[model samples]
Target chain A: MKVALDAMGGDHAPAVNIGGAKEALELYPSIEKIFLVGDEDAIRAECQKQGLSTTSPRIAIVHAPEVIGMAEPGAKTVRRKKQSSINVAMDLVKAGEADAFVSAGNTGAAVASATIKLRLIEGVDRAGIASGLPNEHGICHLLDAGANPEAKPEHLLVYAIMGSAFARHVLGVKHPKVGLMSNGEEDEKGTTFTKETFALLKGFADSGKAPFDFVGNVEGHDLFETQLDVVLCDGFTGNVVLKSCEATAKAMFKWLKKELTANAVRMIGAKIAKGAFVAVKERASAESYGGSPLLGVNGVVIIAHGGSTAVAVRNAIRVGMETVQHRVNPHIEATLQDVKR
Target chain B: MKVALDAMGGDHAPAVNIGGAKEALELYPSIEKIFLVGDEDAIRAECQKQGLSTTSPRIAIVHAPEVIGMAEPGAKTVRRKKQSSINVAMDLVKAGEADAFVSAGNTGAAVASATIKLRLIEGVDRAGIASGLPNEHGICHLLDAGANPEAKPEHLLVYAIMGSAFARHVLGVKHPKVGLMSNGEEDEKGTTFTKETFALLKGFADSGKAPFDFVGNVEGHDLFETQLDVVLCDGFTGNVVLKSCEATAKAMFKWLKKELTANAVRMIGAKIAKGAFVAVKERASAESYGGSPLLGVNGVVIIAHGGSTAVAVRNAIRVGMETVQHRVNPHIEATLQDVKR
Candidate 1:
């Protein structure tokens, strides 16, 4: 699969991006070619510094001088910076030059660029960011992680379909159990928006025409515990919930570390169980999953974290390639078409 | 202070409630009386079984013949069950016989009974549930924990005031720092509802007229860190966020325990550091905080979890007494009156 990666995206771009690209090529034989979309000189220098052959047939340079900043307004930046790496990379996908596009840059810019360049699949209202979060049962896909702040009830239905499609093929959940994020687990819980969407989805879930099992309602805490395959919510709640959990985990670990080192006896015990702590951290971290895919969009678009490391970037590229191989967009198009009926 | 205890509210009912009342009486010399509100026979039996003096001047039995089930509708149940323990306890507070009311029962019923009978304070539109969540930096109060599903910007101002008052007096947080819960830290990063609230809180926070330090936009992750005293959000978000964090912690501990006991070496390591784990659990558990106070009402109302144990019940009553002693309602009233002027 051919992929166009925004070379100057993330906080530590060029170097980390180049390193990740090289690693991706080495690890995945399916990645036929990668168009390193950014400034030609910077890309080549970083490629050489990272000990990768600049002339390698598998890697190509597509010079794009402009760079969309992480904090820049997304839609405006995408519209203004025609030559930005994010836009240029997406252009490659639009032109059928690459099967997928990856960026760890401005999330908004990435979404806007993909929406503008690749456009949305038929019957799709808006694209959603579907992030794979670590849960007790395994990974659960959280949609609208921050793509659309204000969404209509029908929009959530679209998210559910797209998320379920992504979970089934890309994430490999056989029968994804979909849950609507709400204040409570009761059937009547949630805002009017959720109530309307719940009614539609509940009916659809029972029709057997739906792609997954419909677990009526799920609260914030239920996200990690229940064996749910896909958790759907508006971008605002999803973003808030994701970050809140992240902050909680970070604080807990900080507290744990402080307590563990408070005394020599605790320190000795901590040392012995150091491996277990590391294991837990790894299992709980977002680094393991890398970027989330912007589902319902026409092309494969993966938006990585702004502070992504080389490992995270590599995994993002891997995700992009896997998404293309699974033909998620086509499946989503088919589902949306069915939904429209 | 005189406090009314709803003896038939929670899962364990009369036993835990009676045990908690006794414990509270022993722990706080200031507690003059506890009117155990429930079926007279059941309360007497539980009090006797728990080795409590029924005829003691400090402990009184208030007969409440009916009981509201956990799943009953909030307003309907409160109105229909006039003799329910929760209603009777709230009535005691309304009648000036009890300084505060504590319930380890249906949260909706508690909130409904408190709102309907005790009524809202001057200049307050609605009541809010201010839950004290155990964070790394002592405790942070999350308001509208599950009370108001839809809140106007003005309502949030009241929540911020009420929550700050509870924080400063009962929580002993001096010059409490308050944060408006949003999806992002930036001023512009929130739903339209949150945006307006942010602007108002931002001004109030700066005007120094507000009781708490108005720390602008905080994400869910900010709950345990940042030394923020009170985090204000609509009840829907607050409840979902609170429960989500709880679920995440519980699931993480479960996973940690499983991994630590998977092998002999890991099991030995876990055994050595059991104290540290126990200490960490204690720090994070809700039992340490007791119940959340339903603020903005005319009287002090603390609602414990429906599944609260004896220790939790004891803690809830203690919170109620402390709230009364602190005179949080008057302070909230002053803040609101000042805001209006």
Candidate 2:
């Protein structure tokens, strides 16, 4: 299996990407190759500096002339910068040269490039970004994290199906339970779009066309309960929820550390509770779940965090590889067909 | 000050409400009046069982003939059940018999009753539910928490103004900074509503009519940071973010406790780290911030948690009193007029 890595992406740049590529190659021996898509000279230099054996036959480089800044418009940048790292990596997946593509670049650029280059499945109208959130029970999937900000009821229905497919195939969940994220848990609690989407899901469930259980509306508080396998919402609400959770967790950990270091007694207490502290930190870490996957697209596309480190990038690559191995795209297409029929 | 308490509200029902009212009277000696609104017999029995004193000259009763179920339709229930506890309490505020009203009842019913009885302030199209999110860096006010599910850009602007006013007056922040919550921090990252709202806020900032500082768009991740005093968004996005944050904090605290009690060694460590644990718990506790206020209404209306205890109810009453004392409504009206002018 081959994976295309956008070495020019993320805050850590070529160094983190190179380190992650080395780690991925070591962990998965069956992974025959990695096509490092970026400025060839810069990536190679970073890899050499990291004291990695990049001279191996399995390692290769694909030069890209341009880079898309995080602030650039997604549609315009993807079209104008055709030779950008994201675009080039996506091309590798489209041409079947690489099984999957991983990027820690601007999310908008990565999403737009993937959708435009690899194309969407026949029945999929819009692609969604799915992120795994760690909850008390386990991990739950939130779809359309920030892809389409203004989604119609039909778009939400598609997200539900695609999210369910991803959960079942990649996350190893059987008979995944799907839910629409709304203001309240009741049937009549959401906006026009959510209400319409709920009706559509109900119809699909009654017709026995939906692949998983339609568990009705799930509120924000339900995200951490793991009551549903997949939580579906329009990009706007999903993004806000996703970002707020991330911010709150970071703030909580920061506050804990500050309070622990405030006095001598608390400092000693922090030392005594180091084990529990580590447990909490590990559970809240975003790197534990790797990167978000852009579902509904024809090929695998993983969008890692912009601030991703070596470990996060490696995890993202592994995620992309697993997605290909599990054939999530084809499964989503089949599910969409079922929902339509 | 006189407060109307809904005796038959919340999951705990008459017991919690009755006990809470007694505790409030005891805690706040200056609270001269209390009207227990519910079935006269049930409230009197509960008060007697708790061995509390409600025979003071300030104490009174307002019997509500019926109760609105939590699952009832907002508009229909509010209109039909005019004698419900929620309606009766709101009526006290409307009739100027009480300084403010407190309820741990159904949120929809509380909102509807408050809106119908108190009426919206002139120039304000709708009322918003505003909650104070307790983060590591103090508290940030989030508006339209679940009031209006489908909001226009103009509605968001109004929410921003109301949230700013509440934060400044009640939370004691001078020139509260307001932020428009969006998928990305970039100025152009939101949907049409977000983009237009951003432009409107910028225009306000440029024109010097806006009293608060418009801090530009804030991503969900910034909620914990004191980047802004008030965070503004439509009801749908705001509600999702609010619920998700609450759930995440609860789950994190629960997980920490469970991890600490796993074994004897950890248990001993927990004992040693009691101070640190308390610090963490206190920092994440939601009850510390009191209840969420419904803004833009003619009168002060606070929606306490449905599971509120005596302490929560008392704190909510204090919030209502503070809003009244600070003249938040008039301040908002004046500021809004300045913006229009």
Candidate 3:
């Protein structure tokens, strides 16, 4: 499979991208080629600095002059920076030159570029970003992480469909348990938007045509506590929950470290228990998941965190490859046909 | 100050309520009396079982025959179960028989009863729940936590006023730093609701009549990372973020404990580091905060967690006393008079 890496998109930029490409080539036999789309001179320098051979046939440099700033507005930046690395990488997928496009840059830009370039799959109203978070049972994909903030009830119904398809084909859940995010667990508890969404989802589930079981309304704690496969919510709510969980985890670890190093007794104990901490941290780290797939798009497009490391970038490429190999988009289109909302 | 406790509310019910009342009477000399509103037989039996003296002048039990179940609907139940503990407690505040009302009951029931019985403070269009969460600097109150799910732009404007008053007068911050909870930090990035709210807050800030500094649009991560006093959002978003943060912290601690006790060496280290873990746990506990204030009501009303412990109930009564002693409601009315949207 051919993959296009957004070499200039991310905090570490060309360095991590080049390193990731090298690692992907070494690790995956399925990767036929990796097109590094960025400024040729910068990519070449980073490859040389990182001791990655540019003469390898698996590695190719596709020079693109423009680079989108991390904090720039999403759709606007993508349109303005026509020759940017993100745009070029996405174009590779659009032209069928690459099987997937992966970026650890501005999420808005990637979503906009992918939606505009690749277009939504037929029968799909909107493309939602299904971001995965580790839970007790397994990963719970939070659909519409940030793609459609001003989503309607129909949009969420579609998200339920798309999220279920992703869970079944990609995450390997036999019968995904889906839920609607709300303030309360009761059926009548939600905003006007969510209440309308609830009725629609409940109707679909009652029809006996739902690919996944609709678990009704779920509270925030259910995300981590319950045995849920996909939790459906508007992009606005999903984004806040996602970021809040991330920040809380980060804050807890920070405080734990501070407390564990408060004195000699704790310091020694922390040293002895270092392996336990390392194991838990790795288990909880987003780096393990690598990236969130922008589902409902016509092709595979994965979005990693802005501050992604080389390891994270490599894992993102792997996620992109898996989405393609598993044929998640085609599965979604097929599922959508069986259940029309 | 005289305070009313909803003894029949919460997961633990009369047991925790009676125990908490006993502790509060012992701890606060400023608390003159506590009215325990619930079934007379149940309250008396629990008090006797816990060895609490019902003959004490500071303790009084008011009979409330009906009880509103934890899972019951809010407004409807509050009206139907007229003799419920939550209603009777709110009536105590309304009749000037108690200085404050405190409950570890159904949040929706408490909010409904308080708004209906005690009424809204003049110039307050709607009431909001300001739920506090501990952060790096201090506590950051999330306004409209669950009170007004379908909040308008003007409703959030009232939340800003009420939240600022709570932070300044009760939380004791000199100048509260308030932020609008959105998906991004950019001023233009938010749903239509949040954007409308942003404009109202920005206008209020620009007029130089605002008690707090408006920090434009803030993402979920900023709730912990930044030095924010209050974050304004619609009830639906605020509730989800609040619960998500709580759940994430709990999950992390649970994982850490499991990993730490996996082996004998790590178990020994964990035993030695137990103090550090205990300190962090207490620091991150909702029991420490006791309860969330249902702001903008006619009187001081506090809503504790449904799963609150005895310590939490005691702290909630303490919070009620502090709010009454601090004259938070009058201060809010005064602040609202100074700024009109």
Candidate 4:
């Protein structure tokens, strides 16, 4: 499938974006074309510096001069900067020129651009960002990680359906077990919103109308231990948990490094154990899973991290292509159809 | 100050409870007495096993025949088991016989007992648990960590007040900065509940009637890096964040250990780095904070972890004594009066 990548986005900018597109081209022959949507001059120079020629049959440059800085208001920027890289790239997908849109830009901008340009899929309450988090069993699809903070019970129900669809098609989980994120594990637990959502999910899952398995209420820590495929929550709670996990991991590693290098003996030992640490870090890194997908949109959109490296950007493209190849939108639409009735 | 210790509570039970009380007696000479409120026989045996005699003038065994199981329903158990260790100890505080009560038992039972017996201080809407979380800064106090899930905006307003009081008097901050936890740092970044709470908090702080500094909005990660004195949210959000952080830490350590011990070289390195790891673990541990205080209650009640060890139990007693000394409840009552009007 063809992909439109926002080349002027992320901290590393056009260089990593261009480098990533080139690597994706080499790795995935299935990626027919990558439209480098950014400032024309910057994209060309980065391609040249990286020893890549945009003249290649598979690589193409699409000029969109304006760049949305990371800190700018999302909806405002998208509206004002009509020719911004993010807006233009999304427009490409909306026009059916590209199967998917990928960006390591501002998440809010990405969500806004997609929501406004592509619009939400029919029967979907709101779009959500589904993130793949590492767990004991494998990876758990957590949504909406940040897309819609002011969400209702129905929005969460739609997230459950879309997240399950992604887990089934993209993550290759058969009969994925979906869970509602709550403070307690009991059925009687959760706020009024969650309680209402839980009843709907439970009824639907029990009736065998849905494709995924339903695990009633999963606590926060259960995300890592419970070998469930999909974990669902409102965007606000999901975002809080997601970032809290991120902060905790970052703090722990910092503490670990400080402790390991405190004394000479530990430093020597750290050398010996460097490989293991590297392996662990790679396994736990977000770059491995690429960007979170903005599900329930009319088209596929992958929202990568702002600090994404070349590999991350490449992986994001891979995720985007896979999402398109798996026909995630079609599947999500079909799954949500069952809920609408 | 006199403290009532629930000797039959927690996983390690009577032994640790007795041991902790004895240690607290030696460490804090201001502790006038400790009422070991539990089964008389079990308390005496544990005291004798730990080579301590109940005959000591400062130590006394208050016979409480009933025990509340961890899995028992909280409100019902508290009402039914009136002579339970938790209830009896809370009674010690209620009857003006003990300055404070500490328990490493069922959290629900602790909350219920504190609320029912001690009651909300004066005009407070509800009682909240103020938990100390270890972060980049020394500590960040997170309130309503697991108390009232159905918290209204006014309840949160009171939480903000009580949290600020605890931070200033107990934590010794000159002017505590209180933050409302949200999905984003922006003013308009939260659900309807949080939006209402945010508006109320902002108005109170801006009017200069609020004692603490109000930081508009804080994300989950900001808990560590921001160095803000107190973070306030509804209990559901706080509990989810709290447990998610705990789970992430546990999972990371498990992952690290698996990686570090995968081979002999790493194992040797781990041994060399053991000291640093221990130091980091101790620094990051919840045990160091004793236990979360059930804030806004009329009497001091420290809720220790159910899996608390002897040191944690001792620390809980220390916290209880400190809370009583600081007169946290009275201060909370006074601070909240500004908003109650």
Candidate maximizing lDDT: 3
Cα-based lDDT at residue B71, candidate 3:
91
Instruction: Write candidate 2's Cα lDDT for B219-253 as tens digits.
Output: 87667776577888888888888888878777788
The alpha-carbon lDDT assigned to residue B240 of candidate 3 equals 88
Q: Which residues of candidate 3, in runs, are more than 4 Å off?
A: none
**What value does DockQ give for candidate 3?**
0.81
Best by DockQ: 3
What is the Cα-based TM-score of model 2?
0.96
TM-score of chain B of each: 0.96, 0.95, 0.98, 0.97
Give the Å shift of residue A244 in candidate 1.
0.8
Number of clashes recorded per candidate: 4, 0, 0, 0
Clash pairs, candidate 1, are A220-B244, A221-B244, A244-B220, A244-B221
Number of colliding residue pairs in model 4? 0
At residue B100, what lDDT does model 3 achieve? 91
Task: Give the poorly placed runs of model 2, Cα more than 4 Å off.
Answer: none
- Candidate 3 CAPRI level: high
Candidate 4 docking class: medium
For A47-76, candidate 2 gives per-residue lDDT tens digits of: 889876667877989999888887788778
lDDT of 3 by residue, A213-278 (tens): 999999878888899988989999999899999888888888899999999999889988888899
Question: How are the candidates ranked when ordered by DockQ, highest leading?
Answer: 3, 4, 2, 1
Q: Give the per-residue lDDT digits (tens) of candidate 4, residues B154-194.
A: 98888887888888888898788889998778887788988
List the DockQ of the predictions in order.
Answer: 0.65, 0.71, 0.81, 0.72
